[model samples]
Target chain A: MNEIRIFSPATVANVSCGFDVMGFCLDSVGDEMVIRKVERKGIHITRIEGFDLPYEAEKNVSGVSALAMYDAIDVDFGFEIEIYKKIKPGSGIGSSAASAVGSVFGMNELLGRPFNKTQLTEFAIKGEALASKCEHADNLAPAMFGGFALVKSVSPLVILEIPSPEDLYATIIHPQIEIKTAESRALLPKEVALQDATTQWANFGSLIHGLHTGDFEVIKNALHDVIVEPHRSKLIPYFNEVTKAAINAGALGSGISGSGPSIFSLSKGIENAINVKDAIEKVYAKTGIDFDIHVSKINSKGIKIIN
Target chain B: MNEIRIFSPATVANVSCGFDVMGFCLDSVGDEMVIRKVERKGIHITRIEGFDLPYEAEKNVSGVSALAMYDAIDVDFGFEIEIYKKIKPGSGIGSSAASAVGSVFGMNELLGRPFNKTQLTEFAIKGEALASKCEHADNLAPAMFGGFALVKSVSPLVILEIPSPEDLYATIIHPQIEIKTAESRALLPKEVALQDATTQWANFGSLIHGLHTGDFEVIKNALHDVIVEPHRSKLIPYFNEVTKAAINAGALGSGISGSGPSIFSLSKGIENAINVKDAIEKVYAKTGIDFDIHVSKINSKGIKIIN
Candidate 1:
């Protein structure tokens, strides 16, 4: 039955120091999955277009999470699933989160919308868990609710809305490189000094205040992360020089986009955003790295289907 | 030269996880210091009413900070200083901060208000260093600016004003037994796990959201301190039972107020606040502890001269 067809958007997680609990929906950059009920009483999965993708059901992250949802809810139904992977697979954005959220969002519509955002978020979290062993909803909430969002607590996944500055623009530069999430995470320290942690909290507290008050300078200062960024930054070839140049070129702040390889710089306007993108691209050019630069507004709306 | 006389309030530093970077004005409970320009060559000191407090000029925390401004600016001026201690000594609620802020606030006024809140806070922090051996300004901002506040970054002392819930009521219970702030601080760990730090950031991030959005429940869940309160809670007698009782009796959240010996439970209204306060007081009574309970609204205005 096509009555259950639904679409979900893509999201970004760890919006600066909010590791597992903070994320937001961007109007641009996302994926869409459509689920349909069938009388076959079995799950069937097939890639709609891309030949660079997997074909196995059990191995496919989306199929696994969707199957898990059906099994958990004990829903006796078969489904046909199609994924429009608008967001590039390894963009350091929420690629799988978009899939998980899409399947759950579409499946719920197919299943009479039995769950609310929190409940759906719970199911989507399971989807994330199936992929990462840990359920990080920073990417999910923004995908689900559309606009800047946060998960207050991960245990219950208390997602809250974060204030977004209107004049802000983001420039994302993805230098084609392969650094698996596992390897990236492994490079991070398992423990940090208490003083550094306090600094993180202080920055985080101020970041929220800046967002709420629409003060960009506070946001700029609060974007400093002494815990993860410093250690993981070494992986990227010219992270220091590029970031420094970006800031010098009038970008408000810059950081490793998501889990790295890609870099993002936030700016106050279009000119500053373009300068940030150009600055980041210049570093990749010096390293003989091929990259794609996207200068866009903070996508307030997360995921939407083009078709 | 009778310049305008003004009194600055005492503040509570280290709101559990927000160490050295968070404080709020106590409109009612704080010390008062008056500054009036006099025909003299140097600053003079006077300790006014309130429990016959010590008036050690050379080593006085406020006196030292106020004196630093004169040395730095090289403006030799004469002024009469008076300290009317309102908040008790060794109380976790910024006893030292009151005098520091008072002196700085008064000195700024005496100096034609050349120093803004940040500068005054800096001077106040210098005063804090003389007493606590640490330079911090959390208490000074709230003492100077009033309402719920965030100190943000310490080096530059970036102060921010967080929106407090409209009906926020603070029920402070001070047990007669004294607990030194240094001892309470000493009980904390030097290092914290990555997972725990992530959780703390989630809580901290949520706290800002709670304060900004006025979500009492979010604030309640976000008020926990994994880094400090867990370790420090053991030192306070009946801390466990008091917190349990307060939460059970409709308190949004409860914790060791400031450095403790004094415990505070936050509630949305008078009835719930009183209920939580009485419940905790009842628990304290079981241990035969003599405690004074103060049930009042969060004083948005810190310290004001009555006469």
Candidate 2:
């Protein structure tokens, strides 16, 4: 009860039509973290492997989120954290979110689950803000609650967990390049055309309906981003080609995963997802870009206890 | 079947967050029309009653939609329409849509139902455009398909019929004022702040989810119009007071019914709807506006066969 190990999932935010509001978790891509309660009265980061990130407890994402959760609780004992970061930071697949959610989720479990998912998401976004320079729950909610999550509102913190289809799979390609979330977000216009906004909401509503009804054709037709992708895609090399390749290879839909450098496509099954991954890989290979491709089932469980 | 008699329900469109895409049909507010097949090869409006309207088939809302549908099919006989209109034009409770849907729905039945609902909507919106000066399916889809409907897209014509909660009811108050749909639409800004747009889509997506799950609290919270109501409410006298009265009297949500002079509020049951109606009537009565209030259950069947 004093110690916990958990798998915190990588997630794809922005999901085309649902920019800034929707996301889905990945089962095969994540980071593992171990948290142990200590007698000391402060949070500590004992170890971090596989990625060179800030180790200072005050500066780290996991530490910042854990501290937020810690300050709100009356726990006498402190927590020691060790992270095995597999999802690379700035790859646009919610690496910071995985770490952010990991700390809060693990800490909550060790404290006998004092906080609900929404509260955990609230704490996690404080950490997420450190990385994105914005407090958004799109990635944090899905990584903490799993399946497809829609951050309905951040102020009151309403998060709806949309049902993921049984056979839904994702193919993600993380190009070995960094596109800072803050910089990519800065490229977006402060205002959008009302007509374009209308189209975006229509598509977003349709996509949610499609997910609920498990209609692939509706999903494909509705998964389009008219607001953010056009500007952000310019930051990532060969974004259009990769998306085309994914769709042509049978993905239900494809788009820039988050603030880009990573692109994701959703398909109906693992086989189709593999095909999409291969198609994307072929395109990325020709671009002479080093990349990592992952084919994964949509994670139904967000953060899992790993004994 | 050489002739058909039908009741075409009026609709409330742009339901708060779902501006331009969402609507619901009403049981008590509608128009009744009778259509007969004739040897002549054209559409004709044979009789006019209850409300003064254009008798010419080319100019009348019903006749215009009937012609659109009539020309598309290779029907052997022309159609004669007798209209008993109950909904008032420029009232903004989709009077044009009821008429438009009435013709197409009655024609489809008289011809042994040749066209599907989507095709019928296509014809109906042609007539709606004549009144509103824009082609929108929010009202038409609900009028044709009944209950709650989302016009996911207008061009490709994807309509999603959302299930209404069993106990849902509507209260509508028409203040006997005129607000042209075209003029109201012209009042909207060409562009909107990205933050407002994001909030709008969030509420929209949440509203859809709330409807699907039948969660009243979620519906109440999500039933906000940040994008349109602020500007359009100015045209409707005592708009704020009426809305506040409805909410205070236990209506789930209230907003301008279509491009309003008519204000609509949805409540959980008939009793609440009546209470809301009384409350709205009280507010409008003090303003010296001649108003008509109607309380009815949600219409599950759109264009019903009367005889």
- TM-score of the candidate numbered 2? 0.98
The residue-level lDDT of candidate 2 at A95 comes to: 93
Clashing residue pairs found in predicted model 1: A9-A303, A26-A299, A26-A301, A27-A299, A27-A301, B27-B301
Candidate 2 Cα misplacement greater than 4 A, ranges: none
Candidate 2 residue-wise lDDT, B22-63, digit = tens: 999999989999998899989989998888888998899899
Which window of ten consecutive residues has the lowest lDDT sum in model 1 chain A? A1-10
Q: How do the residues A47-158 of candidate 2 rate in per-residue lDDT, one tens digit apiece?
A: 9999998888789999999999999999788999999999998888999999999999999988888899999999998999898787888999999999999999888789
Q: Each candidate's chain B TM-score?
A: 0.92, 0.98
Error of 1 at A307 (Å): 3.6
Model 2: how far residue A190 lies from native, Å: 0.9
Fnat for the candidates in order:
0.88, 0.72
lDDT of 1 by residue, B199-306 (tens): 888888788888888988888888777777888878788888888998899988777766777777778988998898888878888888787777767777665544
